[model samples]
Target: MDKIIESFIEDFKTEFNYEKIDKSKLFEHYVNYVLISKIYPDRSSLDKINVGGTRNPGIDGLAIMTNNHLVTSQEEVDYFIQDADLLDVEFNFIQSKTSESFDMGDIMTFIASVKEFYKDGELLFEDDLLNLRDLKNYIYKNSIKMEKSPSLKLYYATTGKWLGDINLTTIINSGIQDLKSLDLFSDVKFIPVDGDKLKSLYREIKNKITKEIIFEKHTILPKMDKVTESYLGILPVTELVKVTSDDDGELIKTIFYDNVRDFQGFNKVNTGIKTTIERKNANDKFVLLNNGITIVAKTLNKVGSAFKISEFQIVNGCQTSHVLHHMKTSLEPSIFVPLKLIVTTDDDTINDIIRATNSQTEVKNEAFEILKPFHKKLEEFYLTFEKDVNKRLYYERRSRQYFGAKAKSEKIIGLSTQIASYIAMFLNEPQSTQRYFGELLNSYSNRLFLDNHSLFPYYTSGLAINVIEELFRENKLNYTSKKFKYHLLLMFRIQVAGAKVPINISGNKDNEKYCTKIMEALWDRENALKIFKSLELKLESVLAETKVLNRQAYLTRAFTEELLPTISNAKKEGKLIYYNFQKGFGFIKVNNSEDETFVHYTELSKVKINEIVPGLELLFDIFQSPKGAQAKNIEKKDIVKKSI
Candidate 1:
C-alpha cells in the first residue's frame, strides 16, 4: 500500500478498539480524494471545493453550482460573471468522520449538523469562506422567489459500518420533509458514503465504462422471437443482491450512471415498495404487486444455469434493487425477481431498452440526455456549429465536463439533461401542463423503442435554449414565474412545429443557421396549425426520421449486401486522377467541377487493392466525413470514343 493508504488503515484500525482516532486531516483527505472523486466522476469539487473549519457547520466540503437556465440580464447582454457569491446555486455538502461505526447518535448528529448549516449559517471565519457565506445567505434570503432553486445534497462520508434503522432513516426523511414543506429549495437528498460504499466507489472509478455481471437462474421464462432478445429467466434476489451490494458497486453504478431517475434514498414511495417486500403476506403478492426488473446486456451466454452478461445495464428497477439491498437481511430468502435480460451486442439497442423500461417513477424528467447513445444526428449536428455568439453551446460527447460545478465557461456551455426534456416535451406533450414531458421519449417515435432520429439533436435543441434565453432577455422576462415557465415550454413547442420545413429566425444569413431554421418555423400560420391542431410535433418528425436513420445505420450491411444508398448527391463523372496501387489510396478529380477529393482503396468497389493502374475513369458521389469530402462508391466507367 502507498503511505496514505497505510496511514489511513492504521487510523481506521485505531477506531475499531477505541472511541475515535486522533483528529487528523488524513481522514478528510481520504474522503475527499477517494470517496468524493468516485461518486462525482467530474471531480467537480476540489481545492476550493472543501470548506471545513474549527467549528465546521456540519459541512466538510461543498460544490455550489449556478443554475444554467438563468435569464441573461439587460445590463449584461452577452454574459454573466461567475462570482463565487453568485446567488441561488446548487449545493452538495460533504461531512466526513474517521469512525469505525455510526449508531443512532452519529446519524442524528449528521442530520442536526446539516439542519444547523441551513438554520444558523454564519461565516466560520471573517477572512475565509466570505464568498461562500455570501452565496448561502443570498439563497436563504431569496428562497421563495426562485423557480427551481438550489438543491441541497447532504453527503455523509465515513470509514465505518453504516448502522441503518427505521429511526435513523425516519429522522433524515423528516428533515427532508420539513425542508420541502417550506419550499425553500428545489429538493434535498441524503447519501451515506460508508466504508464499504466508499471502497466500491473507488473501484468503479478505475474500471471501464461498462461492467459484466453474473445472474444465476431461478427459472427459465418465455423467450421473444427477436434476434436481439435473450436468456429470459428469473434472477434470485438473494443471489443478485450480491451484485447490488458488492464492495465495488461497479454493476449498480455503471448501470444507473445514465438512468433518468435515481435512488431517492428513503422516499415515501420507496418505503412503500420496501414495506410491500417485507410484509408478512409479501411472498403471496410479491410477483403481482411488484414490477419486475428489466435488464439489458451487450452479450450473454449461459454458464450452466447461470448467465454472464457483458456491457450490461439495469435500466429499470434501480430503486427496487436499492430497496432490496438496504433491507436485505429482513427479507424472505426464497424471493426471486423476474428478469427479461436481452442478450445483444448493439449499443443503440441497449439505449432503446433503457429508455423503454425506465418509466415507473413519478419524478418530472429534466431531459433526454440519458439516451445519448442514439443521438448521433445531434452529435453530428453539433460539429456543424459555427462558433459565432449564437454557437456557444458544446454538445458534450465524452466527459462529465458538461455538468461541472466550476463557475467557468466550461460549466456554461455543457450538456444538460434539461435540453432533452425540452425537445421531448415539445414533441410529446405540448398542451398538457399536468404531464410536463412524455415518458416515451425513446419509445414514442417507434413501438420498438430502438434508435430513433425524431428526437431533436443537442445542437438544435441547445440552440433553441440560447434563442429563447436571448429573446426572453431582450423582452426583460423574469427567471422565476409560472407563466414564463409555460411560455418557455410553448416556445420550444413552436420551434418543433416549424422544423418539418424549418423557418429562419434572424434577418441575416437567409436562415443558414440550423437552429434558426428550426426556430423560425414558430411563426408560420400553416406550420403552426399543423403542429398544434394536428399535433404534428418534433416527436412525430423524430419518429418518422428513425426509420431512415435505422436504414442508413446499416452501412456494414450495405458493404456486403444490397441496402439503401448511404451517400446522397447524384453520382458525378470523375477521374481516378491519381492512383497509388501500393499505398491503396488515390485522388479523384470531378469531370466538370474543379474539386479534387481523396479516396481510399477500401472506399472503392470490393475488388483487390492492386486492381488497376492510374488514370482509371470512375463515377462516384461526394460525401462528407470527419476528414472533409471524400469520394464514395467508386465504380469503374469505360471511356467512350467521340467524334473529334
Candidate 2:
C-alpha cells in the first residue's frame, strides 16, 4: 500500500475503533466512507454504508440516496414519499480490494453482482444488503413520484495504481454499456479508484474548502452589527455554475444551508427556472424573473474583481442552484442571476437571514430550532470535555461542524441522534423517538432541548447510545439488541438509578450524582459491556414471559411498560439468594448494598407464598425487626431466576 493510504487507514481505524474488523473489511469501510463523503459529507453512521459480509456476493458497500438524505430502510423511503416529494434518487455501489492490484475476474464478479441486484427473483442478500434491496424495489415501485430517472454510480477501488491498460479499459467500458442498456438509469458511471486517488479524496474531505469567483458587477451595502460585509449584484450564469459545481461537475451539496429545504426537483417552479435558462432569447431575463440567491460566508477576501470566499453556505435559492447546475451547458453567456452575499460569523444573524430569505418556501419551524441558543450552549458543553479522550464527544449543531473540526466521524453525535437518545433515556419515551421528526419536534417541543434542562443528562443519554452502537459493532450484543437499543437506554438508567425519574435534573445534586455514575459506566468499556449484558438477560426474560415475538412490539409503550417493572424491581430490590421452603425463612440480597435481609413466609400473600422459589428475584422493603433486618412489603418481579 502507498504510505499515504496506509497512514489514512490507520487514522480511520483509530477514529472509528475498527481495529477488530478484518483488514479487507476495514479497507472496504474506508473506501466507502472516503468516496461517499464526496457527495454527502454529513453521514452520521458509517456502518449503514457497509454491506459486505457473508452471503453478500461481490458488493462491499452500497448507499441509496433519496434527495440528499441516505435511506437505509423501507420506512425511510415511506417517510419521504408521505412527507416530502421524492424528486430524485441515486444508487452508489462500491467494491474494494486490499490486494496490490485489481484483477479482471474480480471486476467481472462485481459487475455481475450489480446486475443480479437489479434483477427480479434472483440472488438474495442478508441484513444491510437486504434492506438496501428492499429500498431499491420500493423506490422503483414508486418511480412515478420521481421527476427524473435514478442515476447509477459504480466505484471499484484497489490499493494499486491504475496504469491504464487497454484490456482493463475495454472491460470497464463494456460493463458501463451493459448497465446503461437496462434503461433503468439516466446515466451510468464507473470510476476506478487507485491508492493515489483515494488519498486525494481523503484529503479533499479533510481540507478546508475555498473557492474564487468574479464579483466585479456589484454594489456595496452598508454593514450593520455582526455583519462583516454585504453585497448585492448579478452573477453571470457561467460564473455561478462554477461556484456550485465541483471538479467532477457534481453539485457541491455541502455548501447548501442545512436548514433550507432541499431542491424540490423539476417541480413547477424549478421547471420554469430551467425553461427560462434554456430558452434562446429569454435567458437574459433570468435576473428579473428569478429570486436572487443568498450567500453567507465566514471569511471573504477581495482582490480587484475577484473575491476568494471560504466556509460559505447558500442560505437560500437551493432550487434555483440545482436547476442552474442542471442546465449549465445549455445556458447562454448573456444570462445572469440575482445575488445577495453577506459575511458574518454570528450564528444569530445567520439564522435570521435564513428565516427571512426562506419565507417564500414552506420550511418547518423545527428546521431553525437547532440555531437557537440552547443547542449552541449544548454544543459548547460538549467541547468542555475535550481534555478527556474517553469522555469527549462532539455535538453537531450545524451541518459538517465535526468535519470542520476534524473530529472523528464516529464520535460526533448528530442533533437527531442526541434528541432520540435524550427522549429514550431521560424522558422514558423510547417509542416516541421512532416517530417522524416533524411530529416528534411538535409533540415534545416544550419539554426537549430546554434552556433550563440539565446538560449532564443529555450528554449521558448521548454517551449511552454511543456505547450501545459500539457494542453492536463489536458483536458483544446480538442483532435483536438493535431494535431495542433505545429501550436498553431506559433500562441502563433504571439499573443505575431506580424507577423514580428526576422531574428536573438541573440544580439537583442527587440527579447530578446519578448522571455522573452513568457517565463513568459508559466511559469504561468492560463495565459498560457488563451492564448491557445484565440488561439483555432481563430483556430476554421479559420477552419470554410476555410471549411477544413481534419485532415491532418492542418499540411500543406497552412493551416498555411490561419490561420496566421487571428490571426496576431487580435494581430496587435485589435477587432472592436463599430460600428454605420448609423452614419458611430465607435471606434476600439488597441492591447496591453488602448485606442481606431475612424474609419470612408471613410477609407474602397466599398466592405469592405458593409461587415462592429459590433464586427468584423479588421486590421488597427492609425494616428493623427483633432479629435484625427483615423483608417487608414483598412483591414478585416477573423475571427468570439466576442460579444461586
In terms of lDDT, the best-performing candidate is: 2
What is the lDDT, from 0 to 100, of the residue 507 in candidate 1? 33
Candidate 2 lDDT (Cα, whole model)? 0.79
Q: Write the per-residue lDDT of candidate 2 for residues 250-369, one digit (tens) a residue.
A: 888878846468776777788898888767788778899999889888899999889888888998988888888988778776788999989998878888898899887787777777
Runs of candidate 1 exceeding 4 Å displacement: 1-34, 37-60, 63-121, 124-200, 209-229, 248-254, 263-272, 299-302, 358-374, 383-414, 417-644
What residue runs in model 2 are displaced by over 4 Å at the alpha carbon? 121-124, 163-166, 173-183, 257-259, 384-387, 402-407, 427-447, 470-487, 504-514, 536-644
Q: Give the TM-score comparing model 1 with the true structure, all chains together.
A: 0.42
- Any residue pairs clashing in model 2, and if so which? none
How many clashes show up per model? Answer: 3, 0
Q: Each candidate: what lDDT?
A: 0.50, 0.79
Pairs with backbone N, CA or C atoms under 3 Å apart (clashes), candidate 1: 367-421, 368-420, 454-542
